[model samples]
Structure formats: C-alpha cells, structure tokens
Target: MYRNLQLLRSIRYSYSPPKASVLLDVSNCIQGLKQKLQELNELKVATARKIADYDPMPKLEVKMQEEGFVIKVLSQRSCQGLLVFILEAFEELGLDVLQARVSCADSFTLEALGNKISIS
Candidate 1:
C-alpha cells in the first residue's frame, strides 16, 4: 500500500505543468530590445541623409537700386570667382551690374537688377 502511495505521488509531481511566466517575461524583454535597436538604426540613417543633403553654395539674394543696381552676392565661392561669374552673366545679358557687395556663407545669395534696369 505504501509503495502504491509513493508511486501516485511521483506521478502527480511529474505531471504538474511547468510555469511559463518567467519565459514570457524574457521573450517580451528581447522583443522590446529589438524594437529599440531598429528605431536607433532608422534614426542613424535619417541623420546621414540629412548631412549628405547639405549645400556648400551660399544662398543668392539679388535686388535693384537707382544708381545702376546694387548686387549683394553672398556665397562660399571665392570672391574672385563669384565676381567673375556675376560679371560674365551680366555681360552676356548686356546689363552692367554696378557696386557689388559680397558676403560669404555655406551658400550664396545674390541680389541684383533682373534685366529691367534703364542704364543712362
């Protein structure tokens, strides 16, 4: 009788379901880590693309004035090169740009008379 009782107890213990709560918690943690890593990678790629899109030329802002035209050309290009290009373009169009003021930056802004000037 005692042997039967011991055998029944062993069988009950062996058949008990294993607790899975700890395993589930570990799986959730791993999944969260994976999601965080993916987000970081996306952020890195976006930052790289933004950096690559940077323009080295200065922003150009052109305007006109009464005494001929005031050409304010802001650019990262060397002053001589910028002046040469501007003068060449003006010459090509047969419009003389006078009194140029240049500023330097990452991009250029040129403000000059837009082919609508009356030169005496």
Candidate 2:
C-alpha cells in the first residue's frame, strides 16, 4: 500500500546522517590537539638546546659572611647564560638563592652577582 511505502521512506531518511555541528566539534578537537602537540615539540627543542649549552665547570669565588656567602664569577658569555649558570651552581651547593643582581656595560662587558641564603 501507499501508506506502507511512505513509512519505509521516512525510516530510511531518519538514519540519513549526523548533524554538521557534531562534525565541527570533532574538527575543533583535532585542531586543538595539533596545537598542543606543536607547543610541546617547541618546548622539547628549547630544553635540549639549553642542556647542550650548559657548562658544568665555571669558576666560582665564595666569600664567607656572617649568615651565608656571596658568589662571584667572570666569564665572557651573555648575562642570561651567566645567570642560568649561577642558579644551577646554587642548586649544586644545596643552598637557596635569596636575591640576584646583574650589572653590565654596553661596551661588551657582563657581570653577574648573586646572594645566597642557607636554609639551615
């Protein structure tokens, strides 16, 4: 009968496809994950470069004080590099760095000074 044909056609069209919004949500999720992966990759590369450039043996002069000690160093590297080195040195010495001061001249000279405080 004609009624039976119409009912079958309705059921067939009912299972036609998913909504466009669902597809858009899936696409957005994929793009977000791709962006996160790219950021992680960039972080990995930067960390690797820092590790490679690190110097394990830099000259350190320690001056004893009433509470703690002061550290000094002289190097022809960038101020940023010296700062990183000084922080790592404090970590190795099992001391806490209380404050850091850096001075430099525009004529290609860099000076890094750090004050350390003992936890004990």
Candidate 3:
C-alpha cells in the first residue's frame, strides 16, 4: 500500500504542468512581436499599392545656364496638343529653341534648350 502511494506521488510530480514564472514571459513577448511585424508588413504593402495607383500631375523644370536655358517637362498621360502649347509659350516669351528632345509614345516628355532671341 505504501509503495502504491509512492508510485502515485511520483507519477503526479512527473506529469504535472509547469508552474507559471514571476519573470517575463518570453514566448508571449516573441509571439506579440511577430504579430506586430506581420501587421507592419501588411501596412507597408498597402501603402506601396496606393502609391503605385497614384497618378501625379505634370511636372516642369527650368534651369538658367550661362549660354541659354534648359527646360524639361513630364506628363504621365498624353495630351493632344501639349507640344504646340509649349512652342507657342516659348514664342510668346521671345525664346528661340536651339535644341529639343521629345517623347510621346506612352507618356509625354520634352527637354529643350532655348536662348533669348535678339530683337535687333
């Protein structure tokens, strides 16, 4: 009978669940960090998709050089008569285009070098 009691006690002690610690729960912390990281990754992907779907307005840049002016224009979408409008504006400004590079296949891009025309 004493041997049976001893066997029960040993079995109970060996098969018992682990006691909770007073210290930090490292596994829970790691699991929480993993969840947060996954959430951040999902957010990052959503932000990137939003940025890709965004269509920016046309952009223009001009720089004054010693000899002339360098102008660059970009349009994400093709416009029907944007080139003519640009040329007319240059004419109104009394600028003569010395050189130009244009692309209109998918988008619109224009790079031009111009100098002020002498009135004389």
Best by TM-score: 3
Per-residue accuracy of model 1 over 32-59 as CA lDDT, tens digit each: 9999999999999999998777656665
Q: What are the C-alpha RMSDs, in order, of all predicted structures? A: 12.0, 14.1, 11.5
The per-residue C-alpha lDDT of model 3 at residue 104 equals 85
lDDT of 3 by residue, 1-120 (tens): 545544554544443333332112434556789999999999999999988976778889999999999999998877889999999999999999999999988889999998999987
Clashing pairs in 2: none
Quote model 3's TM-score.
0.56
Q: Is candidate 2 or candidate 3 better by TM-score?
A: 3
Highest-lDDT candidate: 3
lDDT of 2 by residue, 1-120 (tens): 545444544544443234444445556767999999999999999999988876655455677777666666644344546566656867886776665565544212323334454475
- Report lDDT (Cα) of residue 26, candidate 1: 47
Candidate 3: the clashing residue pairs are: none
lDDT of 3 at 33: 90
Q: For all candidates, what are the clash counts? A: 19, 0, 0
lDDT agreement with native, every candidate = 0.60, 0.59, 0.81
